[model samples]
Structures are given as structure tokens and as C-alpha cells.
Target: MSVQPQSFSSLEQNTESENHSSSSQSWTIEDSEQTYQIQGWGDPYFSINRAGHITVSPQGDRGTSLDLYELVTALRKRNIGLPILIRFPEILADRVERLYACFDRAISRYNYQGSYRGVFPIKCNQHRHLVESLVKCGTPHQLGLEVGSKPELMIALATLNPLQISEKEAQSSLLICNGYKDREYIETALLSRRLGYETILVVEQLEELELIQAISEELAIYPAIGIRAKLGTRGTGRWGSSTGDRAKFGLTIWQILQAVETLKSYNKLDCLQLLHFHIGSQVSSIRVIKEAIREAAQIYVELTNLGANLNYLDVGGGLAVDYDGSKTQKNNASKNYNMQNYANDIVAEVKEACDQAEIKVPTLISESGRAIASHQGVLIFDVLGSNEPPVTPPPVIEEEEHLIIRNLWETYALINEENYQEYYHDAIQFKQEAISLFNFSYLSLKERARAEQLYWACCAKVFEIIKHQETINEELQSIANILTSIYYINLSIFQSAPDHWAIDQLFPIMPIHRLNEPPSKRAILADLTCDSDGKISQFINPKGQKPKDFLELHPLDNNQPYYLGMFLVGAYQEIMGNLHNLFGDTNVVHIRTHGKGYKIEQLVRGDTITEVLAQTQYSSEELLENLRRHTEQALEKNLISLAESRRLLNNYQQGLANYTYLKANDQESCIP
Candidate 1:
């Protein structure tokens, strides 16, 4: 099984003219869509255009569109390199609009009196540009922000407008602080209340409550407070453990009662205006969502009866993005519900629970971070090279050939539909025997190489014979995978998409152009990093199938470049990346379309070699000094001439200023 069936795709090209014409006619945009599952996962934002290039319509089909291939060409013309992260702010705005629209419709259908307020969690994506864009687009709906740390609170305060702080100002944004708070954090949050912000310091622990009370007294500001309840109803999926009794954060029922008593003792019960609970992030089941809401609503009702004036129900971030486009609970990467469904269930469950208790329905607030941020980013990288088997004919059989090589050649020549399996087994045995003979010094290196070539040839022939069979057994499938190509991409899995490597999160990846041609090769992506774990083997399967180990790709043409886009990377990817192997961030570009064209509003350069080195405490000046010293020592010893030493130092200095990624070849600049 250790033998690699490498020559499967490297067999002689099919030269039949009629077959080529038929294949060309059969492959269309629709076929490409099905093959890549773009429509399944990339509904409103991405599609294949008439020119066989992938097009992005940030606000959906009727909105202005741009071809990704053309955009990359423009970037090249501007001297920007490959491995770019593109942000479409229009997509963010559209996601916000849809989120509010769904709740509005639900409110109308239910004839509910309470309104919906949306909040963006800063933890999902801490990038300032993305946070600012979401706040700008969401302010019209009284959209607010939720922060989990001191740094996030500062971001929220700086990004949000504080025109009016009074609760009566219905349009003023709210800031909900929900983490373990220290005295400094509490003081800052409570002080923001005086500066005209509707700031709520959500108490995650009973200890935080006393700290908030002491900080507010010291600052002479009464802070509006929220309590995070530990819900009995747990979520479903990978994040489900974040809920229920043993969750990392949140107060138990006893702690909630104790906090109410302590607030009553301080005559500050009225300051408790919000009740928050989070099921988890990316909740795949709608039923879990509804059940958690019902439980939390019951708590809200009881708290109201207990003299706590609660007016806001904050359902912390669990809105799922349909990453795989399955629209089912088939995997962790997908959700079975849409925005409308989520809004409807939350609204109905909360309304019913409040109605049964004859309590006023509180304003519904959702901290949906993933669904809002996931669709706005696309990561583009190029295929630097590929490792595939040779395409030449098999080695000629000679009378002087080794017996093992002759056996492999005979296995390949004699394989057919009825006996291919038997021949493949025989070939594997022959290969193992050849390796053992070579180890024992019974076979020459030339003879061993010939045996390997013939063994792979047999594998290729067997694959061709069985590929079209009605049933491909497990062994045949394993052989097929061993024969697939390893495409070395100009990307770092740790720096660009840590979730994929860390948690096996799947993202939709496909070529940006050449959709008209059918993909003829199966491949797994290998990043530029030397680490073995830095490879992408899990891929989104077509429609209803399970995830696969290989991605279908077109054979690379030497005359043109191949670019692939990784979709739905807007949430959690940017801020989670690490400098594994010192591979830093990719170049970032913000784009917005106008009518039929697009403009690049901003370009953030990636880290240079000196910058990454400095991040790890390597001083650039010191590095240069050390190199100069080495050059001087060489010169003193007459090991190298003065001119050579100077040239070496100059080259070292230039490399420090260069981008961490591989530079684009000058010849590929004219790829358009």
C-alpha cells in the first residue's frame, strides 16, 4: 500500500478528435456550477459569467458585478502580487439589510409590539475596517456592538457614534460589554455611560457584579447592567458544549438569584435592563435555537417578576452561515436554516413565552457575528507548481531487463476489465519484492528505477480499466487518491486560513476562470510551508455527498496561470492567523462596485521580511550589523573580495525589505 500509483493521470493524452468535441460541448456554465457546488454554497454573491470567469455580485444578481479574473489582472497591472484578501463592503451591507428585513417581516407576521435590534460581536472579526463598515451600514437600524474584552470595547467606542446617550434616544447605539472585567475595564465602560453612550456592563460572574458596583460608585455613574444566564437547553454541533451547566462562562440559576438579591440590597435592581445568554456560535439546528430562546425568555419573565426591570433580550452570537451550501444539518460547516427562519423562530418563541406570563415583550437583540461577516471576504492565491507523475510512455522491455521489471511490464500489458484487479495485486507484490532485492544488494539502482516505472505503469493501466466501472471498491478509491496530484499553492494555511487547519473548517475553493473547460485532474492543495500539516485535503463535496479528500482541478497550462479563490473567509480568519514558518499576512484590498465597474478603495500591504523578524524580537539594525561584521571578517581573511562583500551585504539588505511571500514571475504579469 506504500507504493504510489502516480502515473494514473499521466498516461498518454486521449487523441480522439470526436471525444474532445463531445466533452467541450457537454461542459457548460451549469455543469461547472454543479461540479464546483458554487450555487449550493455561493448563492447571491458568486457565479460563473458568460466568459467562463467567476463574477461577484455583492448585493446579489441585480447589483453591480465584477469578474474576479479581471480584478486580479488589474491588481497585477498595479503591481500588486498574488495571495490577496479582497473585501466587498457591499456584501456586508447586504447581509445586514437581510438580517433586519427578516426580523421586520417576522414582527409584522406575529403582530408583535417589540422591535428588533442587531449587534455585531467584535470577537468574530476584530479588523477595524470591517467593524467600521458594519457599524456604518447598521446605524440606520439602531445596530449596536458587543465586546468581550477591554480592547474590543475600545474599538466599539471609537467606531460607534455617541450623538445622544439617553435611553429615550431610540436611535442611539448600545454597547454591551460581556467578559471578565477588571476595575479598569469597569471604570472605562461605566465612564462611557456619562459620555453619552448606552453602555451596559454585562456581569458574567457574581464577582464581576461587586466590581461593577464599586467602580460605578467610585466614578459616580450608575451603569445599565445585563446578566448572562447559563441556559439549561444546550446547543447542537461542535460549539454545543459552550452552553448548558458546565459552560466556560455564564451564571447558574443560584448565582442569578444571588445577583438579584445583591442588586436589590444596593437599591440598584432597576439598573438591570438586559438579560443575555448564548447557545454557541454556528448553531446548525433551528430547534436548539428556539429551545434556548424559550428557556431564556422564561428566565427574563421571572426576573421581571422579581423586580428587575429587564427590557432587552440579548441572544448572543449563534447565527450560522451556510458555508457548504448544504442547507441542512448534514455537517458542522452548514446550517439547516436561513435568516428568515431564524428570525421567525426567535420572535415566535420569545413572544409566546412572554405572552403566557402576561409580561411586556422586550426588544429582541441578536449578536450575530458569523452570518454578518463570513460572506464579505474572498482569499485569492495562485498555484505555484504541481507534483504529478510523468507522461512519457512506459520503459521499453529488453531481454536484459530485471525479472521484477519484466513481471511489472507483463502485469500492465495483460491487465483488462476481467483481470485488472488480479494484475494490480501482482504488481504490488512485484514492487515490494524489487525494493527488498535492492536493499539486499541483489538489484542495481537502474533496475530498481525501471521496476518502479513499470509498477506505476501497471497501476495506471489498472486505474483506467476500473475507473468507469459501476462499483469502485475501497482499494480502488484509495489507489485513485494516491495517484492524485499535489498542487503547491502560494499560500500559508496558518496565516490565511487557520480555522481550516486548526478545526477542519471547510471553505469553498475553486478556480476563478476557465470554467468552460472540464477539470481533468484530482488534487489536494499543499501550501508553501514545509510542515506536513499545512495541506488542505478535506474539500466540500458536490450537493448531497460527504466531504471528499481531493479537489477536482484543471490541468495547468504552461502558457497561462491558474488562480484559485477561497470563499467565506471573512469571519474569524483574519484575526486568528499565526506566523507559522514566518509566513505573514497576505496583501489586502477593499473593493466596492459602482454600476457595472468596481473600484479599489484601499490596499494594505503585507508584512515584509524585516517586519516579521522584528515581531519576534529580531532588530533589523542589529541583523544588518551582524551581516556587515561577517562580511568584514571575510574581507580581512581575503576569503572574498571587497566588491563581493559589498554585493552580499546589499543583497541581504534588499531581502529584508521584500515581501515574505514568493514574488510573482515577471512573465506571468501579462496573463490577461
Candidate 2:
């Protein structure tokens, strides 16, 4: 039987019917939550309310939820520009409390005699406010700080300085110093110990131990020591290589024993108070964590038997945050275990190892910086515009049109359900032929434009047919790519989400409002940076499938603003982001949840044009002077009027002082 051909309009009508039928299902806030997978990664903290706005319950599910849309609206009233970062201090506090509480439960259940102590790794996020807030929140738990560099050590020492004021506070707080230490670094850490902070200088290499011994003797202060053992059990993730014998930091079995013997000879084996091992950050599997802990625990017990005074078992930060919410080991973006499961396993493994060896269960220390900080920060940006294939009826082809263009038009006109595959193939062939013909000067520019338009229209038609189907063949899937729009967002991937661009790290991104409505468009986000790589093509898949290339989004409303939030970026994103295209930072506001509302505690302004230029060695005053000189020359030559020169210079000066990001239109600031 011959398949009947359908007109282009008929194909569109069919697609509209299919879309209306599919989207006609009642979409609620719950449906929105599922579509965005907010519950998967954002459980207990974020949800969509009945009013169609994303709500953040900073204190978790039991606390009052604040509307993110409303919060942005309030900030807009004060004229905050696009691409602002919103931080919830309460979420950080809540994460800390939950982390300690889980370990407490595990310790109680296992009857482990050692107490649990958590230290925030300063390298994870070095924002002063974020570090200070974590310190304050953890003061109750006597939460400590971990530093891996000279700068991070400086911050840790100063941030924890308040603890040194009171002897009780000093004893309660623990400061772990990691990384290869220099003389000044060792002296500073040892001096802090002398001043009564429970500082442990974790020896990363055998050489570091010698420096520690010499520095301590000179400072006349006995330094508390920890050994970072190179574990035999390897990790499993992007950062997994940092573990095992080939690891960059940490000493091997031979080196570790040498350090012990050297410490014994120096009579400083009594200073060996902690054993540390890192199995890499963002651990993907619970089995890996268990294995690493068992190996490290064995080493801890053996060190104790070797007469090294070990009072602390430090599991350096490998705790993972489930950015994709898969909760499976299939990918590196997520973890296969929850925080409680991790705690239980650590406590069980360590206690079993210690009980077998008949040794004391030393204090359990975890540097869980990612889990504590990832969820607390959200980067929000506006959708400036979208670039999509023209849906307007293809321009009427004259009779004299080229044969290649004629073939494309016929394919677009006669595509039907039965022969769309054949027609799609024909269109591709015709488009390629037209491109070759145009390059050979066989086709006019107008003819080429027409051919390109008809090509996209054909793809659009093919996409409409298969979009609602349960499954499409691989060849047919390219139609969806052709139909997807490029949404230009007011965000720089380098300035806000460097990991995504650098390492293919995925963060949960979704519309902040309009949850009651089903999104009708699929788009790949394009950032404002000039670089072609500044775009987010991979998105989190709710079903835990491979990341989707396009994000589902609502049709842009010309009358209102549309915003998207990139969540789980509080860990390394802020500090790791670079000034690509000189985009600088975003306006940051620290929010504290109150009763059914939130208080904006602080607003750190984003970098101005002047500030960013200065970082690149461009003096703003010199820039202005040069521009003024050029403008005066132009006026003297009568190339421009005096009034225009003044106006140009004034605008230039104003632009230098303005925020680095694009300014929001007046229409975008209004609440619908």
C-alpha cells in the first residue's frame, strides 16, 4: 500500500494535537518536583510550592519554606542585577548538625568509645563569610578546621583564633594542617600549638616530619603530629587517583615506618597523636569507603602497637555529595550511599578493626567539606534570549529556484508519518548538495538562505512527529537536536561553574518558578562569554539515565523575566571559578530563614568593570584619561560634537562603575 503524503501544516497540526494531549495531564507542584528531580537531590531542602515558585526550607523539611522567586523579587527591588548567588547559612548549619548527629548515632550504636569530630576543609570553599559561618555553626560541636595550603592555613589559624582565647575552647577545637609545609608554614602551625590551639601538623611526606621536628624544637613547643598513610585500597572517581601507593601526597609503608622510627629517635613519637588517610573526594561507592576505612583502621592499630601514641583516626575528606541525585555508583556525579550510611560504615569498620587488635577506638575525624557546603549555595541567572530555527512559513520559492533548493522545498511540503524517514534522508542529501553547489558558485546567496531555512523546517517537522513517541531511532533523534534552541543566559560558565566546563561535572539546573506549567521547549544554555565552550549541554537526568543534552524549559514570556538556578555549587565552584571574559563574580547574598520569611544578612557586590580591569593590570584612571584624550582629538577634528564627546565619556565612566554582568531590563524586574 502506498503511503499518503501530508502537507506541512497537517504535520504541525498533528504535533500540536500530540503535545496538547500529552501536556493536558494535570501538572501540579509535585509533577514539577519530579520533572526537575528536586526531590532526588534537593530532598528536605528544596521543593516547588502550590504557587509555582521554588521554595527553600533551609532548616530542612520541618522548617518554614521561603519562596525563591519572592526573594529574588525583593532583591530586584533594590536593583540587584542578573546572575546573583544566593547562600543559605542555615543549610550549612543544618548539614553540620546532621553530620555530627549521624556520627553520634553510629558511635552510640557501635559502642565506640572514641568521639566524632568533623573539620571543614578550608580549601573546599575559602569564602570568608562561608568559613566563618561554618566555624560559628560548628562551635557547639567543637567542629575543627582543616587547611591544605599556606593561604588556607593562614585563614584557618585566624578563623580559629577565637577558640584560643579560652583554654577550654582551645582544647575543644582541632586544627589539622595538611599539604607540603615550608619553614614559615611549620613555624606558624607550631606557634599556634604553643598558643594553646589543639593543632596537629599532618605529615604528608617523610621530609615534612623532619621539618616539623626541627621547627618544634626551635619554637620550644611540642607539636602534635599526624601521619597521612598512602593507602593500598584505591578510590573510584574523577579524583580517585589521589589514593593508593602512587598518590601525590601521603607516605608509603616504608616511608611511614621511617617517619615513626625517626620520631622515636627524636623522642617525638609521643607527638604522633593522629593517623590520616584520604580516599579522594566525591567518593562514588560505599564499598570503596568501607575498604579504605578498613585499611586505614588497620594501619592505625599497627601504629599504636608500634608505640606511636595515636589518639585520632583522621579520614581526610572523601565524603561525596550527590549532585545528580542518582544515589548509585553508576556515575561519578553521585554517591551510592547517604551520610548516615557512610557514618554507620565508618564507625562499624573502625570499631571492628580496633576491637580485633584490642586497641582504643581513637577520636573519629572526618573532613567532610563537600557534603557540608555543596547544598547551601545556589547560582541564579536570567535567560536573556533564545536562538531557534525560524518557524515562520518558508518563503515561497519562485519557479526559477535551483534544483537543490527545489528538492528541499518538496521534501518539506510532502513529509508524512509513513515516509518521514525517507523524506528526512532526501532533505539531508539535498541540503548537502545545495551547500556544495553554493560553494561552487552554482547557487545565489538568496537561494542558499532559502535552502538553509527549508532544511531546518524539514527537521522541525520530523522532530514534531517523533517527539511524543515512546522511543525514536538514533538517526531520528538528530531532529530533536536541530529543533532545540540555544538559550543565551546571563552567566559565564568560567565565572560560576568552572567544573562543568572543565570536567563535565553536572549540577541540578531548573526554572525557579512556573512549576504548575509544563515546560514546552528544550534548550541548551549558552553563556554570555565569547568562547564557544561557554555553554552547558549536559543536564541531570531524573531517571538516572545518561545526562540529557537539552534542558526542558517553559516558553519565554515576553512580558516577564525567566530565571534558572544552578544548585549544589557551594563546594568548589565559587573558589575555582576563573575570570574568563572578565565576567568576575556575581552579587552574593547570605540568607537566614526566619518564620515563614528570610533575612538577607549581607550582600557582597559583584566586581565592577573597573575592578575586573584592574585585576588584569588596566588602570581605570589611565583608561579614562586615554579615552578622554582620543575624544578631545576627535572633537578638534570635528569628527564628533562636544555634547556627544561628553555623553560618550560619561557613559564610559558609568559603565566602568556598573556591575560586570548584564543589567536586567525594567520589564524583567516586575512580579507577575
Candidate 3:
């Protein structure tokens, strides 16, 4: 049966105007014509053009036009294939610099008393290139580092310490230690402080504060202290409860007061210099953030009023970056607030709240890991193939035909009339009856095949008649939706985008090329895995509509490679990816934009069979030896020839040398 055609609106139409100052503007396609203009957060950077092509711009760079077509061309030239993660250091630096600028502008505007310091949390994308870029970009601002684990701490300490970057700017970036602590963790924090780094041990539990105090005293170092308070106002996203009473970390109100009294009693209240609280990550709504910030600011004032030497309000990392351009609620991928608004709201609320409470405005410290790191990386994967609808054979009629077949043929003929509603209903009923009769063994195999063919023909005719109607029935619409094609992708959801499969995190996914042509198919993506659950049924269409489908893609073009980009994956994907099916990490390429164009500075190959086996304590040499011995014995037994045995061994070694997935160049060699 021929597929029915469907038309989709432009993505620009879905963008809502955001509230921005006169100085800040937005980008949009004007008048449904194919023209691109840069706008502020009011207009979505990602939208479908009139041709139904997905267009995207990296956050913050407005005037510079980098559409999907340009991105694909630049990426393909480097020979990076499917499941490749692209790192744009320029975009990362821009985000880091813009954040500091926003805070700097806010500080100057309000004449705020306290200093502002920001850090990139290592928990979000700890890839070497990303972290290096963050450190380099943030060196001007003395950007700090936040660590939650030993590995993350190692990365931060190794990169952010004064020893790494000898410049005066590098010496200024501080290190903030978070998460569960043990003896080694505390020792590392103290050691970092000893290395001339301003290390702040954020106390999640009161017991941790005591442990930290003891460690500081024992080590003979005056380490700074930051207390994470469990605020009453909770955020509204996936990581929303990260700050409230039910949060995994932070102290309760009573506990905070008790800790302050204990510190004062010990004359260590001066060490209690920073107050921290994390409402959540990817906080979509501004109202929730405003409320949470106001609550935290009030606590900061209370601590100050109690004569605690709290100089910094460590607003622990909730500044969100919108992954999906649609500013929807609790999507994890989208946010309702922008950077300027976030900074302004924090500064204004703190100033007002502190003034009301009769306390000094504490210095603002943010641990914005995702916002700093998410935009720096992009996961580019090629579409190896697509699943097309199966072709139906033409119906054959006999002189002595069954009654059901005759009735089906008659119904198919009736469906072609102009006023076809009644005929369509009759056709549908007759088809269902024919199918039931065939299933019940009332019809022969040949008759059943003819009935099925006639049924599909009737249905196809009915769809043709209703295709132009603006308002179709719900049942017909559902059928049409199912008929929408689905494309099978070449990447694993568990490996590349674990958050999407695990936490329902929606990253902005679009075709990396073909932006100039109208996409003919309404498609959902399927991954190459043995599991049936490896398909991506939900997608943000060019019109910004959420379309879920099982079969909505056209046949794959074997001649040319198809690619889909999973954007905003720079945050947690790398660190969170699992070894499901032993399909290790994707090959990572760090792309830096220069005057000449984009350059691939680093290419980290994905984990090979040897590397993956090493993790399980298996030696490749031993495995090869055993396989060779087995094959030799089989050859001696005449199960295989000597030539075949050698060929097999060589093939096995070659397989081990190659990547897990086949590249475009590999298709040229056909093994006889």
C-alpha cells in the first residue's frame, strides 16, 4: 500500500515570546518565510523551518549562524561516525564567560557587597577535554571546581590546583568538596587546601561537619566550611528535592541552628563561612527557584544574625540550562528561566531578604555544573538504516472465488467514491469480518491472502479520501499516526543517552543535516540492541509537537548515511553511561572553532574488546591463545582446512583491532 502524505508546520510557530530587556533580543524565522534571525530566550533556537527541517543554535552565540547542515558538514569531514560525541569548546567557553558576565553585571548594577564565585561540578561531564576547556575558559574569572566523589576530586584537584595552571588566574580558582566523606576524602580536601587552594568542605550531615572540624584541627590547617541547609521550599524538576527536607543531602533547620551553636561554643563559628543549599538541578520554573532562593537567603540572614561568620551563600548548583528549546515544566530538558533572569532574581532576592532581616548580603557562590558543561558537548550518531513498511502483493482473483473475497473486492471498489464515508464504514466492517473468517479457518490460505490484500486496498483508499480533510475522526487519526514511519538508529539508548531511558531526560534530538528539505516522514527512533525496549518512541517534532509512534519512518537510503544528533547530552551522559551489552563509550572528538573553521583537537577512541575485557580481568592474549589452540585442533580433526583455520584466526584478530561498530569505509571490503 502507498503511504499517505502529511504536512507539518514550521518549528518557529511553537516558540513563545520570552520577557527580555531591550538590550537582549531573540532569534526567529519571520513570516513563515525561510529566513533566520537571532533572538533572545523568547524565541527558541531550535525549530523546524518551513521545509520541516530541524534547526539549532548553540546557546549564547546569536549572530553566528551554525545550522544543522553546517554542523553535519564540519563533523562528517573529520570522519567521525555514529555514536560520536562532539565537544564544542567554543560554546562551552561562551557559556562559562556569559555566566560570569551575567553575575558581574548583576553585582555592578546592584552595587552588591559580597563577591561572586562560580564552579563547574565534576559530576557533570568529567571528560578531560570538557574539564580542560572549563578550567581554561573560567581561569579569567578564577572559576572554582566542585567534587562529589574521589574520582571527581582527583579530576578537579589535578586540573584546578595552582600546580596545573601556573598563571596568576589559575591560582585563584577554589575547590569545593561535596558528597559523602570518609577519612581519605577529608584528607584529600585538607591536602588540596595545603596545596594553596581555597577548599571548602560543604557539610551535608552534621556529623560530617564534626569530622571536618576534627580533620582541620588535626591537620593544623584552617579549612573553610560550607553548610548545606535543607530548605523548606523545594524545586519542581527531576532533581527538585535535592535541597528540601527530603533531600539526600543537607542539614535540617534545627540541625543547622545546633551546628551554629556548637561552632560558636568551640570558637569555630568563624570557620563556618559559607551557607549552601541545592533546590534541584534543571529547575524548569522560575517561580520555584525564586521561592527556594528567598527561603535560602532568609536562612543565610538568620545564620548571620546569630553572629556566625557566614560570608558566602553557597547556592549549590540549581541554575538550569534548557535542553529542549520548549520552556515546558518539569521536562528536565527545558527550563522557564534564562541566565540573566536567574542571576537577577538571586541578587535581587538576596539583597531584599538580607535588608529585611537586618543582615549583610553574603557573597554569592554557585555550583552550576550542568549549566556550565551541558552545552559544551554534543552526541552525533549516524542512522545506519530505517525500517520501512512491508510491500503487499497484488491480489489474484479466480473464476470460482469465495463469497468473503468477492464482498471484500466490492467494498474496496465502493471506497473510491467521492461521498465515501458510508462506503468506507462498510469496507471496514467487511474487512474485519473477512479477517475473522480467515482466522477461524472458514477460508482457505489462498482466499485468506486475497481477503487480506483487498482489506489493505480498501483501507488505503479510505485514508486517501480522508487525508485532505482538516478534521478526521479520532480512530482514523490514530490509524494515520501508526502508519507514520519509524527510523531505526545505530546507537544504544542505555549507552549514549541513559538519562532518557532511566530518568526520562529529554535531550534535544534532531537530524544533523537535510535542513533544507521538508521531512516526509513522522518518525520515532529505534536503537540497535537485542532488547525490544531499545526504541525511542517519543520525539520533539519540527513544529515543537511531541509525537510518539511505533512505525513512522520511510525506508533507509543505503547509498547515503543518515544521522541524528542528540543535543545537550554533555552534562550527565558520559558519566552516567552504562556498559549494557558490553557496548562501551562512544568515540569522543573535541571540536574547537578557529578562524579557519572547526578543528578536531582530540579524538578518544571508544573502548575496544580488549579494554572492556580488561575491566572484567580477562587477558586478550590468553583468550587468543585458547581460541587458536581450539581452531588448530579442529583443523587437525578435518572439521576445518588449514587455510580456513588461518583465515579464521586472522579475521578474529582483525575484528579485535576494529571498532565495535562498522564505519562507512568498512563496507567496501566484502569477505568471500
Candidate 4:
């Protein structure tokens, strides 16, 4: 028998029915934010404003909200487009001030004698703008720079070289040199002291003592020295493996003793003043920190007993930021303690250890890079579009429909909690038989269509029942996630948020605008890269699955523009990003508030196709030559006339000069 076609009227009616059931109010904006744990994770720095937008509070106050819509409007005029990094220098300043205030509070509450000297690790974020803002804000409170590599040292040295430092200022505002060192690195550290900055060379191994002595003798300059102790107290969190005894860097306890003896032998033990120890980054436990501090503080006392004049206890950078907003240690990304409590725990532990050791309280140094810079950088990107699947009932049920289609439809109509399992099982079994029979041409196309529709309709009803349920079995959970929509985003995940792809790190992702409007779709983000792995499927949720697989995004307005902002991306995201698919960095705009509004202090253009090519040692001239050859072949084959080919080549080359990221081609923006 000939199969009848599904009518358009039936399809339209089914679609409308399906859509009405899953109405927009099914998932409101408030529900979306709550589901994503936005309020929990976005404390102090980010919150939803009355305008239904995520307003940046630069001063850390609830007042003076900077509307992102206005900022985007300003950016359009200035030619600084979206997919930009909106950096608040004032936010950096506030963070620095907050760090100091906490330390100051701890010092005062404990009546501790030593000062808190905070230093920012340059490796976390070495952007010129971030570093400069840090220096400008941190320099006043004697916040210093910690450099692990030669290049980082150079950046620190060059940035600070112009600042005229007096003897008092030099003592207070210090530069710390850490990591594995070569002869050249040691030489550079010693050379930096000539500029009158009290630069400390931290010895990570025992042999580094000889290098420091040799260099000091060669230049007739005595450089300040510190020791990084490999503490027995290891951290617990994402970067915990990088700490402990057998870690990549730091000196063993035996090595630390040997280095101290070597210093004594050279009569330069006073140079061994700063004692540094790092447990790891994003350490969640306060107890781990206290234990580590006790171990290092005792070592500090023992060094003083051995006639080494100890002055500073450098507790290396592990101050965790609340990434998940749970405000508790629910995951590696969430820290249980706040800034003030972190400071108090460290100070009290150190003071008690030193007080019991019968030693003077040494100055405390913390290289809190992540906590300092994480809130300062916000990455903004726009959604190009979305991927939605067909969700409708069958157009018609033919009188002679296949047995499986009739059975499935009957099961769908009979669905209820009491008989859901039975009905769902029957529909699944019948749908499988219908698919197999249709593949072999034993069933008509119209019957096959009806069977498929019947299956989905049953599945949709099952989902609705599952939603009201307090607990769902694993089978139903898989079905729920299977129905998730896909959002196609403009920026490359590798170039923008690498940790999300690499280690499954979840940064706060939400529309910078439209927090007031309810989102209608449960979705995952697909980046611009051809690689399937370049997508963000995991999202933060306190009550749901650990990084519950999908994000809830609003269905596109289709007429107006919309943008999403990724928060706390200041550290490591930019520098660690690879040149995957040759999609370069996004446009960056430094945001600073002026009056009630904001001003773009600087707009740094991202790399072009030609520039990104240069990064991989591919010359632009060579690219043009290859293009020329391809065009010449096309011309000879009569694929294009000489004039059209020339025009095409010129446009291609001009595109090579344009931004590697998406840009507006006309008055209305189109995906590039």
C-alpha cells in the first residue's frame, strides 16, 4: 500500500501544542540563576541589578551599578566590539585593599608584631594592563611582585625600574624571585638590586646557595635570599599534586638545612631572611593552611637558632577564590573560608607557632594572585545562535497504521506515575520494532513517522512526570539531558576559557544582559572551533550534579543582540590559551568608571589572521603566495575571470588583515 504524506496543518498544530506545554515560564530567569548557583558564586563582585543586567560593582558596593548595555553602546561608537575582556582597574584596587584590610584586621586582633607583605605572582596574569594596575594599587601597601621565570622577572624589573625608590621604600616594597634559576636569572636578580629595589632571590634547591654567593661576589653586591620549604603539610584541591615533598619545585627539609649551613659557611646567613612555603593553589581547607604555617614557622625559628637572621615568613600563593559561589568547600573550585578568616587563620597559627618557639614574630608574606586578579577580569562574548530539535506529536494516525505505531500511541495516552514505567517500556519496545521494520521496508513511511512521534510524545510525558518527582532513576536522568539544546557561541573556548575545556573548570557564565527575562532552553555552548572538544558542557550548581552537564540559556530574541559574560577569568586563561584553530584572542577593553558611567581606558585589538600566522612562524608573504597560486589555477581553469579573481584575492588578503574573530559586516551584525 502507498504511504500518505504528513500534512502541514497537523505538523503546525502538534508543534504549537508541544511548545505551549513547555512554555517560556517553565524555566524563569530567576530559576535559571538559582539553578546555576549564580547568587552563591557571584558574591560581592557580581550580582543581578534591577535593570535585569549583571552590573559591575567596581567599588565593591551595591551602589553605582555600571550597566553593560550602555558600555556596549559606547564600545560600538569607539569601534571596540564584543567578545571583549572588560577589566576594572578599580576592582583590582578594591581587591588589593581588601586583602590588606583582612591582614591588618588579623594583625590587630592578634596583637601580632609582624607586618603583612602581600605580593602578586606575575605568572597568574602577566598582561601589561593587569600588572600595571596591580603595581599602581598594590605599591602603596608595599605589595610586591613574585616572578617564577626569567621573562616574568624581566617584566617585573622593567615595570619597576622607572620608579624612584628610597631606602625605606626599597625595604617595604620588595620584588621576589622564585622558581628554578640559571646563572643568568641569578645575575638579573642581583642586577635589579642596583635600581634600589630590595629584590629577594628565593632558593628552591640546596645548590642555589652557591649560585647566589658566587653571583654576589662577582658583582660585589649582596642580594637578599629566601628559602622555599617543601612542607610535610600538603594541600587538598585541584593543584594539590603540585605540592608535597616530591613536587616539581621547592627544597626538601634536608636540602633546606644544607642551604642554611652553606649560607653560614659563607658568613652570609643574614641574607637568608625570608622563609617561603607553598602548599598549592585553590586550597580549600583552613586546617591545611594552619598546619603548613606551623611547619614553616618552626623551620623559621630553627633557622634563627642556627644563627640565620630570619625576617620574613613568605606563605606562598594558595589563597582560593569562591568560583562556585557555594561559599563552602563543595568542590575544588569552592573555598570554605572567606578572605578575613583566611588571614586570621594564617596569622593566629604563625603567631602561636613563633610564640611557642620563643622567637620574634617574622613578617608575613602572601602571594595571593588568583584571589587578587580573578574578580578583576570579565570575558564577554555573544551567542551567534542555537540548535533546537524537533519536538511535536505525529501529524496523523492513519486507519491502517502499523501495529507498533498504534501500540505506542495507546501507551503514550495511558501514561501516569502508577503505570508510567509499564507504558514507557511498551513505547520503547514498540518504537524499536517500528524502526527496524521501517528500515527493511516492511512498514510504511507514514506509519514510521507516527511511531517515531508517538515515542517522543511518550518520552515528553515521561519527562514531565519525572520533573515533579523527588527522585528519578538513572534511565530517566539520561533522557532529561538528551533533550538539551545546543547554543553556538562566537568566541573559541580554547582561546577564551581553556581551563573549562582542559580541566573541566566552570567559570560563571550568564548573559550580561537579560537576567530579568526568563530563559526557555536548557543548553550547552558550542565554540567556533572545528574540534568537538572546544565546547563548555559542564556548569556550576550547588544542589544538582557536580558541574551538572548543561546550562540554561534564553531562547534568542532573533531580532536584538545578546551577550554573555564569563566571570573570574583574569588568572591563567589568557596566557595558557593555545592557538587552536588559529582563532586568536578576543578584543580587550579596560573598563574604568567616570562619573556615574564608565570609560574605556584602552582598547587592545586582538590578533588578525596574518598576526596569528606570525605567532606560528608562518609569514604573511608566504600565505599570499599560496593564495596567488590557488587563484592562478582557478583562472586558468575558467572558474573565474581575471578581474573577479583579482578582486577575490584582494578581499581575501584584506580579510587576512581584519580581526581573526567575528565582526559586523553590515549595519546588522552577521556571523563572520
Candidate 3 stretches with Cα past 4 Å from truth are 1-80, 163-171, 391-399, 416-440, 457-474, 541-555, 664-672
The TM-score between candidate 1 and the true structure equals 0.95
lDDT of 1 by residue, 85-177 (tens): 999999999999899999999999998889888889999899878888888888777788989999999898899986523333556578989
Cα error, residue 292 of model 3, in Å, equals 0.4
Write the candidate numbers in order of decreasing TM-score: 2, 1, 4, 3
Candidate 2 residue pairs in backbone clash: none
Residue-level lDDT for 216 in candidate 2: 81
Lowest summed lDDT window (length 10), candidate 4? 663-672
lDDT of residue 624 for candidate 2? 97
What are the clashing pairs of model 4? 29-518, 40-325, 41-325
Better of 1 and 3 by TM-score: 1
- Weakest 10 consecutive residues, lDDT, candidate 3? 3-12
Give lDDT per model, in order. Answer: 0.87, 0.87, 0.70, 0.81
Q: Show model 1 residue runs off by greater than 4 Å.
A: 1-21, 164-170, 390-392, 469-471, 667-672
Q: How many backbone clashes does candidate 3 have?
A: 18
lDDT of 3 by residue, 1-672 (tens): 321111111221222112222112332224212221112121433454544344544444353335555565555565554567877776777778788889988888877776688888888878887788788877777888889988888888788745335343345457888899998899888878767888888888888877777887889888788888888887776777686667898899999998998787767898888888888887878898889888888888888888888888888777877654555554555677788988988898898888787777887889888887776667777776555443243355555677777776666655554756676677678767877887899887777777777666666566657767878777776645545555767688888888878877666565655544333455677777777777777654222234334322323567766666777677888888877766777878776655535556887887776777777788888888999999988978999988899999998887665556555543333210
